[model samples]
Target: MARKLPELKRRKPSIAEQQRFILICEGEKTEIAYFKALKAQYRSAQISIEYVAPAGVPITIMDKVKARMAELRREQRSNPSVKADTVWAVFDRDEHHKVTEAIAGRQVSGAQVAYSNPCFEVWLVLHHEDYHASDDHHQVQKRYQKLDRAYDPDGSKTPDCGFLMNRVEEAENRGERQCKSREDEGMPFGRPSTTVYNLTRAIRAAAEASRPKRS
Candidate 1:
C-alpha cells in the first residue's frame, strides 16, 4: 500500500476589517447628501462611513464632533473595534465669525477640518472648472448650477451626486492645484479655496484599502 501523505493544515484567509470614519457636517442637507453619495459610490465591505449633520455654525458643529468623539472613545474601551480611525468636521467659511475658533479646536480634539471658503459649493464648482475668484455662498452656488444644470435647479440645495461622483478625480486635481496657487500667492486659507479634497482623499484611501487582494 502506498504511504499516506501527512495531513496538511489549511491556513484561513484573512477577512478585511472595516475602518470607521466619522464626519460631522455643518449643513443639514447638501453636505450630508454629498458625503452619503460618496460612501455609496465607494461602498466596500471593509469600510464604514458615518455622518452627523448638526446643521449649525462652525463652532457648534465642532462642539458636536467633540461630543461624538468622546462617545466613541468610551465605546472603544468595551470593544476596541468600535474605535474610529478618523474624525472630520466639515464646515464652510461663510462669513462665520467663529471660524478661527473652530479650526483651532481641531488641534485639541485631534479631528481634521474639511473647510471651504465662501461656501461648500466652492468644492462643487471645482468639479467642473477651476475657480480662484473670491465669491460668497450665493455666487458659488450660482456658478455650480451654471456648470451643471441638473444641480439644485428647484432650490432644493441638494447635490446631483450622479453628475458629481464621476468627476471626483477631476475635482480633487483642480482643488489641489488651486491650493498650491493660493499658497504661492501667500494666501493659504484664501477665499475660493477648499480643503474638502483632503477629506475625500482619506475616504478614497480607506476604500482602496478595503479592496480584495489577488493571490
Candidate 2:
C-alpha cells in the first residue's frame, strides 16, 4: 500500500524589511505639534511612530515605553518571527530633572532610546527665522538664528515649531474676529502644520540609519 507523502508544513514568509516603533513624551502643544509633523512626514513604507504620555514626567514616559517594549518582547517570544525593531523615548530638556533621569534610566536598563536636540524645542529652532539664536532671546525682535548653518543656508530660517504654533494662533484669532457673528470657533491648535511632517521625516531617516542591517 502506498502511503501519501506527509503534507509539507508551509510557513508564512517573514517581512522583507524590519519594522520600527517609537514612543515620545507628550507635553505642551508645541512639542505635540512637532511630533505629529514628524510622524506624518516619515509615515511611509516601513516605519511607524507613536506618542504616549507618562502623565507626569519624562521618566514616567520612559517607563511606559519600556513596559510596552517588554510586552512586545513577550509577544515576539510566542510568535518567534515577530519582534519590535526599535523603541525610542523623546522629551524636552527643560527645567526639570526628568530628562536627565530618563537618559540615565535608559542607560541602566540597556534599552535604546532617542531624543531631540536641545530638548523638544530643537525642531522649533529649525523652522522659524526669528527664534534661532546662539543664545535664548526674550525680546520681541526675536532675532533667532538658524539652528545650524548646515541645515539652514543663507541664515534665513530655523525649524521653529514655536513660531509655526504662534502663526496658527494668529490665524485663528483673525478668523474668529471675522466670524464674530458665528459661534463655531476654529480650533486653537490650528491645522496640523508642516513642522509635524518635517520633523517626523527627519526622525524616520535617523531611525532607519540607526537600525542594524542584516548581512
Q: Give the TM-scores of the predictions, in the order they appear.
A: 0.86, 0.51
The parts of candidate 1 lying over 4 Å away from their true place are 1-13, 45-54, 81-83
lDDT string for model 2 (52-108, tens) is 644456687778777867777888898887745566565644435666678677765
What C-alpha lDDT, on a 0 to 100 scale, does residue 137 get in candidate 2? 20
Please provide, for model 1 over 1-215, each residue's C-alpha lDDT reduced to its tens digit, 9 standing for 90 to 100. 99999998765655467667778777766787788888888886233344544367888888887887787778888797663557788888987898989999999888889999988888988888899988878888888888777667347757787678989989999999988888999988788799999988888887887776644
Query: What lDDT score goes with residue 24 in model 1?
Result: 77
Query: What local lDDT does model 2 show for residue 169?
Result: 35
**Candidate 2 wrong stretches, greater than 4 Å:** 1-15, 45-49, 116-118, 128-215
